[model samples]
Target chain A: MKLEEFKEREKRRKFLKEISVIAIGTAVGITTYLICLITHFDIFGWNFGLVLSPLFAGYAESFLAKKYLEESTGAVSAFILFIITVVWGFIISNPTLGFNIITAGSIIIIIQAAIPTATNYFLIGMTLAIISHISGIFKKITNFFYKRYLQLMGKLNLDPRIIREENAEEKYHFYETEPDMNHLGVLLLTLEYLPQGKELIDNKGIYEKREIFTFNQREELKSMRKNEMHLKLMASVKKTETKALYNLIKELKNDGCNAVLNLHMTFETLGQDKGENVRQIIVRGTGVVLADKTDS
Target chain B: MLLSSTSTLDNKKITKYHGLVNGEALLGTNVYKDLFSGIRDVVEGRTSTYAADVQNARDEAFKSMEAKAEALGANGIIGIKVSYNNLGGTMGNTILVTAYGTAVSYEK
Candidate 1:
């Protein structure tokens, strides 16, 4: 089989396996909930099976498979239990039709029950109003502390005085303000202003930001360190972390290395007249040339 | 010679083991530079002079380790670890950086 076809088949198999696992877990959870209802099981005036079956089933599946199940998979089991609860409530409310065998009238009754009632609308409206008011107050209170907390953490150096509305035409530098800004904001800003964005100064010169290397902190580091062969050591100190990493990658690529390992990066005060912060990135991975395996 | 901190090399078979190799570098700053660095540490929250010295020492140690591995007829070094120590005293004001790892020859 072709490589792409093989990979596609494998992916489909994996997806099917995951679905089966979730289905089994949900079935077990529902069975436990039914058993609890039939046995009248209760603990401390709470239905133990109803409350904990989904959680237990999800955990049990993960433990048995020797893997961490994603939160969505656990949610699937919980949602199934929720659907069972609704059906049980319907049977309790309309015992005559719900307990009876399937009929057109019973189907109609279920459809009617599924439709939102006037009381449901009122409850939803009140909940939304309460949530909006509470969230507005919460946002204001958190925004007040956010500046102070960031200052306490020594990450915020954004002086509002320096960013005057009158002098808003001047550029606002990210490096001078905060080393770690909202990464998504930086990405979007860069994308919005394309060719000139490489210089990192916007067209209007409003925000002057540096391109941050979007590397997976754990996964990329672990993979490169463990799997890549190293040939030469690459190290550089630049005005920005982006520059240092970018230069290191360029040098490594020039040396014919596909990956880097054992990276040690640090920020140090240059003690220059401007007291600029310089990033020192050292790559100690012995650069190795990956062999062409296709020929082999 | 290829040098890496990881214990193993990827996609390469070890043809020969050349045992362990090591390197050490000792560095000392001038008395005036040291004094200025100490003052700068108090005022600026960092001693750039000391930082530069440590960086130089680390590079020297790595270079020394690479030479030692080469001398042992090894083309690769694995499981490398670096350590830094300050030999403190009036006369013994020195910084020592040491690097050590296993040297091996791998398939080309």
Candidate 2:
């Protein structure tokens, strides 16, 4: 969408959220290991390093899932690492651990890491999935508790959660009514892109149009609502690269989306009618001004 | 029940041991779901149908296992190991799942 707005959205809050989640995961993992080491570390049947690998793998995966989103599913890279570790074990064991390669001693020791790695494969998948799920729950609980606390604090002349909600609500806006052409901050940008050579003009123009809508166009709707979901989607944009408006929607949400107006692009084939190297494009969407009261 | 696959739940003390309990289940799917999920994989981020399906099967297996523990008067389940078995390609293309764990009651 709006590259600048998207970049701005991505630059701070998402990064912080990612860091916070990863930090939480890292703390949980490392603390568990530290506690295990302090207490029943002897319970482990295999090398302690084996235990550590999978624990950290799952820990790393929590962040990986967040950072990479859908790309992190199945965690194929971890699988690749498993294969590499096994092969690396085959090559280095005789020299490193003084065991003949492929011998029972080597195999057993290798199995130590291999077993945990394999087990962690399942563990990591499930753990990451559950971690995401749990984080969502944690967020809900925190919001609930925080809201209650804020209300109580307000009666006692406190401003704690109030400030927190303010900061969280800054980037978001909501509108009840469909922003027609008359609405302030609503700009329908009709962009035409003519392809030069075989390469289509990149989405830079589309991104700019969105940025214009966000910082300049969006600020027009200054009054806020608690929910931004009431903001509607009306984009006619399509990309051969994606199934739905997947990227557009995600990027919009990621980039402090006030609302998403469907991108409509029209190509002019008149002058260059059927010219192999020439194509035109247009983009359209509503930039609604969020109303404090009833908008409709 | 305090279910966990980890060797121990974080900070949650395990006060006693109550032996082990297990549950196993096999689930089947139709060609339509399998085909749609296959196509969906290419289109979306997660195949929610398959995830829900597998999760439901796992939950069922765990529930049966918990039922066994409940019968034994146990309060919690720990150190659970879950495994998947396929009865397909000739065995009717069914999915078999097993959940086994030590049943125990732990103090807060």
Candidate 3:
């Protein structure tokens, strides 16, 4: 064969290899997205524009990886591509399906396939089946929980900010604000379920201790902590809390609340202290009031 | 010396502030570390409810910026910036993080 012809053949072979890698990656991504959609009924109700996001995202990601990694796109990269695809799929899907099951299944399959004695064909088939099955089940369960929670929230006259799927691997953090101070009273009215005050409220509608954080008390605490590390901490805390509060207020505005009367921050803390730092800060003025009137 | 491969004509210096580095590797050291820490915080319930989504947005931004830098052939990214915005009415939040730096080709 002529030297130029040989070079052309080599180039074509390299091109084919690159194309195959991209094609495989795209296939994995698309299949995962489809499985998630099939099991999640809420996803089907999403706007068409949102549904196409994962497809486009997957194609772009695969193309980019192929262009850059070329023949060196290792298994790790492929896995990362899979993760990226799943995340994008969740984002694009309506109601946002949690990826814990999908992620766990993918990891398990990858680990199994990495075993020296594992057969390639067996691994591939097993992984594909497991991924599809888990993805579908997770989507269905998540959708069921989400719908139930939303319905409950609607019935309670309480707006649910986020409806996270109940999964063993899933953790939730929520911050809410009481704009009219009326909600504060209501929260206190139902303090039986609250974390700190859960044990305080009895059937008689009485509490061991009625802790309230008024708007004025909050401002005073902020002023006191102005020069301390607590100030910075409070600033960051309030930023997120205020956001959650703002969103809640927007939802409740038509129902009558001019301003957020108070704010509540609930999060899980790490370490042996279970978030001692946060507890110390919030406990300082746990029941203080910030403002009185809705306009205030 | 048959120097047939020396095809250097006009090279432009592209300095990207907070551009991506590590070749095609996505996520700079600081950005990745910060992102993981944020994620950890969310997982640990140390953050507010929206922190997880915020962290995800931050991660996505880093990935996006890295992709852009890769397209530009950048060596390292510096001067990174991250910002957040909320799409009201239960749509959740959006985070925008940018990494930029100069793209340079070193001659050996």
Candidate 4:
């Protein structure tokens, strides 16, 4: 599709989404108002139920923005605040008071009557936005601690939904033949590590030939049993994999990727000349991100 | 075609090496299946349908990798690795399977 056409469609989609959010917010507001009326709840001569209208409206807007947009909470909240001000002003317009005041003063009096109502909504919106923003920060802190706890327990709880959406229309090149580009981006990683020393090394100079078993190598092997070395290698591999995955997440976050997909790890042993083998781990995956909501 | 998880075949010599090849398969579940699976877990202690679906996805991913290798004119694939991920959350409805390997031409 042409760029202009795509932009036009995106504009329309955003408009509709905003409208839906407003509708939901209004519903929550009206529900709260009705319950307040039924229960005869009041706070300092003002109906406490009325306060809930904008409070819940702001919460609903924040929740939707977090789940869908994920990155535009602040912008959406500001937009919703402006919209609610106008909407609440219109809803509370007193026709009798407007008619009475207009005859004595002017049409400006009618607008002046709506000012207090609009101001109340504006204050509520601002407070809600601030509260939501702080809550979002708390959620992030909690998630960080939770993930760290899981890692401490030797469980890597990586969520695939981190990349929630994938755009298949974009073209990606491959050396052989192009497969369906159902993912956002692709990466191939090869990690080489020394098992006994628990150290990582570069792949260079690996092809140099060495004797199968030197005396020093034999002594080292004798010091540590074959099974011990094997267990250590497995542990090292796990630790390396975890580190690589965390790095991938950080890189993808910078690249605006929501999640990783098609992730797999493969292992191979190079230079397996009796006890001096080099073990290599290969990690490959694609990134998936949120796509255009309208297109989906 | 000969496929092995090891880096080299038992006795065959590799004449040429092709780059990495990969395949991926995604399986989606419906609400009904999820509900029934929950009930089965409570009653039977197993959900056979999900297991079968996972196995099917793994097989499909392996097949896709093999096809990519064939397209590269490779007669053998080595160092094959397979991994599965649940897309969504703990009870996410989508499962993804990915398999990858190095393709090579080997002496018959």
True interface contacts reproduced by each model, as a fraction? Answer: 0.00, 0.00, 0.00, 0.00
What is the full ranking by lDDT, best candidate first?
4, 1, 2, 3
Model 3 error, position A25 (Å)? 4.6
Off by over 4 Å in 1: A1-296, B38-46
- iRMS of each prediction in angstroms? 22.6, 31.0, 23.9, 16.1
**What's the alpha carbon RMSD for model 3?**
32.8
- The total number of steric clashes, by the backbone 3 Å criterion, in model 2 comes to 7
For model 2, how does the per-residue alpha-carbon lDDT over A1-296 read when each residue is reduced to its tens digit?
Answer: 69998899887875565555455544544554455445544322322322443345444654465475432233222333333333433354333444233443233234434564655465566456556564786667766985775476456431111111112223322112212221222222211211111122122223322211111113212211122211111011112112122333444445544333223422221122221212122223332222223334
- Top model number, TM-score: 4
The two-chain DockQ for each candidate, comma-separated, is 0.01, 0.01, 0.01, 0.02
| Candidate 3 chain A: 10-residue stretch with minimal lDDT | A277-286
lDDT of 4 at A169: 10
Docking class of 2: incorrect
lDDT tens per residue, model 4, A19-107:
67656656765675567657766534344444455455555665675565553333233234334433442345432222231121122
Better TM-score candidate (1, 2)? 1
Q: State the lDDT of candidate 1 residue by residue for A1-296, as single tens digits.
A: 69999999988986776777767767777777777667766544334454445543443444433353342343355455545544563355453334433432233223323542532454355446546554786667766885565465344221111111112112223224323211211111111111110222212222122322222224323432332101000111112433544455555556555433333333222222222212222323333333223422
